[model samples]
Target: MLSFILRRLLSGVVLVVTISVIAFLLLYAGGGDIARRLLGEDASPATVAQKASELGLDQPLAVQFGTWASGVFQGDFGTSWFTSQPVSDAILSRLAVTLSLVLGATVLIAVVSVALGVLAATRRGWIDGLVQVVSLLGTAIPAFLIALGLVIVFAINLGWFKPTGFVQLTDSFSGWLSSITLPVIALSLGGIAGVSQQIRGSMLDALRQDYVRTLQSRGLNRRTVVMQHVLRNAAGPGLAVLGVHFVGLLGGAVIIEQIFAIPGMGQVAVTATSQGDIPLVMGLVIATAILVVILNLFVDLAQGWLNPKVRLS
Candidate 1:
């Protein structure tokens, strides 16, 4: 187990390096100079050169990448062009908002999706039809559309929930929950649909296995057979997929944050891009890429743990 973990960690380091190199080249190679973009079209050449040199943008690409990557090891994500603050600090400051949304949506997706999936699978006639219809509606509706509808009905018409903004949990628990409700619902809708569909298929497949028949022949109640034998076996793949979804929840927050105006990493990225904040953009891209790679590694490890067959291989 230790050896496996060490191997994965080494691979993760290599992946992060590759991601950093690619991000650096992409940002440096694209369009106008970042300093020029920030300083405006009418800026003097000397001013541009000074700014570029200050940010080390005039350095050779390899040297610049090396400097940036080295700083990353020390938790410095360079300085934001907009605020002149460390990009790492900016991202970390907003990390809580994104984490709250991701965690809330994840819990909702897991509970609701698995419950509906299992119930539908066990009662495969009318119940299955109803669940499928609901899941289809979730999948069919665009996230922006869902956010809009939620705002219109819940925030404007009924005034039951706030349409936008975040309230820190330390400030007010009620306000925090109220502010997150819409974004969480929007984020969870697609995940719920996907997870439910997958779970339904998994459970059905588990039911067809020989062990399930043996349990049934022993006269075990349907509930017992499902909760004990079927759910355990069927959950291996679903759980694995859940890890991937958790990673996606972070990336997909971009749209949800924009619609709701939540100050998270997604919002940071959007703000940076609009302002042509190259440092912030590059930082976010690298951070997000590292997040994805780490989450995928975790998923693989978890799958191997849950299924001994994977570990053996």
Candidate 2:
């Protein structure tokens, strides 16, 4: 297990470096005058040139990348081109909001998907049909549309949740929950559908296995056989789906955050991209890559733990 973890971590390091390099190059190569964007449209050519030189935009591509990479290695993500604030500071400020939404949606997905999937697999009648219908609609609907619908229904019609803006957890736990609930639900709908389908399929396969019947023949109750034997075996694949879905949720949160007017890393990313803020965008890209790699590592570890037959090495 230790060796497997070390290998995963090493791979994660390599992935982050590769992603960072690609992101930097792409943003750099994309046509844009960063200095002019920072200075303004009315700035003279000479002024723009001076600004670019001062910002090291005049440096060769390799030199620029090397400088940025060196700073990254030292835990500095560089200052935002527009904001002049450290990129790390800006990201860290919004990280909590994004994390709250993602983590809440993840927990919701895990509980709802597993329960609905298991129930559908075990019941195999109207209950299963209902779950299937819900899953179909969930996967079919776009998350932003879901966000709009939720805002209209819960925030406008029911007055249960705030339609926009976020509250920090430190300020008020209940406020934070109420503020994030709609966005979390919007982000979770698709993830729930995908994960539940994966779980249902995996559970069904596990139940059909010979050991399930053997356990039943030994007089193990249906619940015991299903919960203790079937579910455990089914969990590995379900977890894999969940992990992928969770990574996607981070990307999806950008639109949801925008629609809901929530200040988060997603919102920051959108703004940075539009304004061609290279440093901020690079920071977001690296942060996202790290997050994805970390999630994959955890999923791999969880799968190995659940299924001892699975070899990590």
Candidate 3:
């Protein structure tokens, strides 16, 4: 198991490096006057040229890439052209907001999705049918639309919560939670549907297995047969889907965040791209890619743990 984890960690390192290089090169390929764009209309041509040179824009492509990559390795994602702050620091400052929303939504979705799926699979009646319909509806609707609808109903019409702006949790927990609720709900809708579907399929398959039938024939109660035996077998698929979706929640909340006006990493990446903040955007991409790789590796480890026969070592 240790060896397997180490191997995956090595792979993750390679993946992050590859992703960072690609993101940096793609941002650089646009060949715009980054310094001029950052300086805006007030800067003269000579000033822009001087600033660009100072920023090392005149260096050869390979040299610039090496410099950027080295800085990244040293945990320096460069200074943001707009903010003149270290990219890492800028991103980390907003990390709490993004993590709070993502983690809260994830926990809620996992509980709701798993329960609905298990119930629906075990019952196979009206309860199951109703859940399936809801899941289907959820899948069909986009997150941004859900976010808008939620804001309209809960904030604009009902006046239950403020419609926009983010507050730090330490400053005011209630205010922070209120600001995050709509966005979390919006982001979780599609995930809920996806997880439910994956769980349902896996549970149904588990139920039809020979071991499940053996457990049923042994006079085990329905609850035990389903929860203990079936759920254990079914969890593999659900975990796989959950792993992929978990990574997505971090970077995929762009639309939902924008709609709810909650500042997060997704919002940061969007703003960075628009302003051509190459370093910030590239850093965000690298961070997101690394997250995905790590989650996937963890999923594999989990699978091996759940079924010892899989032999991770």
Using lDDT as the measure, name the better of candidate 1 and candidate 2.
Answer: 2
Runs off by more than 4 Å, candidate 3? 39-45, 310-313
Q: For model 2, how does the per-residue alpha-carbon lDDT over 1-313 read when each residue is reduced to its tens digit? A: 8878888899999999999888888888674787888889999999999999988999998999999999998999999878899999999999989999998999999999999999999999999999999999999999999999999999999999889999999999999989999999999999999899999999999888999888899999999998888998998888989999988999999999999999999989999988888899999999999889988998988888897666545
Best by TM-score: 2
Query: Which tens-of-lDDT digit does each residue in 1-313 have in candidate 1?
Result: 7677777778888887887777778877664688888889999999999989998889888898789888888888889878999898888898788889988998899899899989988989999999999999998998789999999999999999878889999999999999999999999898888889889999999988998888888998879999987987787778776777887788778999998989899889888888988789888887777777776677668767767676555
Q: Which window of 10 residues has the lowest lDDT sum in candidate 3?
A: 304-313
TM-score of every candidate relative to the true structure:
0.93, 0.97, 0.93
The model with the greater lDDT, 2 or 3, is 2
User: Local distance difference test, per candidate?
Assistant: 0.85, 0.92, 0.84
Best model number under lDDT: 2
Off by over 4 Å in 1: none
Give the clashing pairs for model 1.
Answer: none
Q: C-alpha displacement of 166 in model 2, angstroms?
A: 1.0
Candidate 3 or 1, higher TM-score: 1
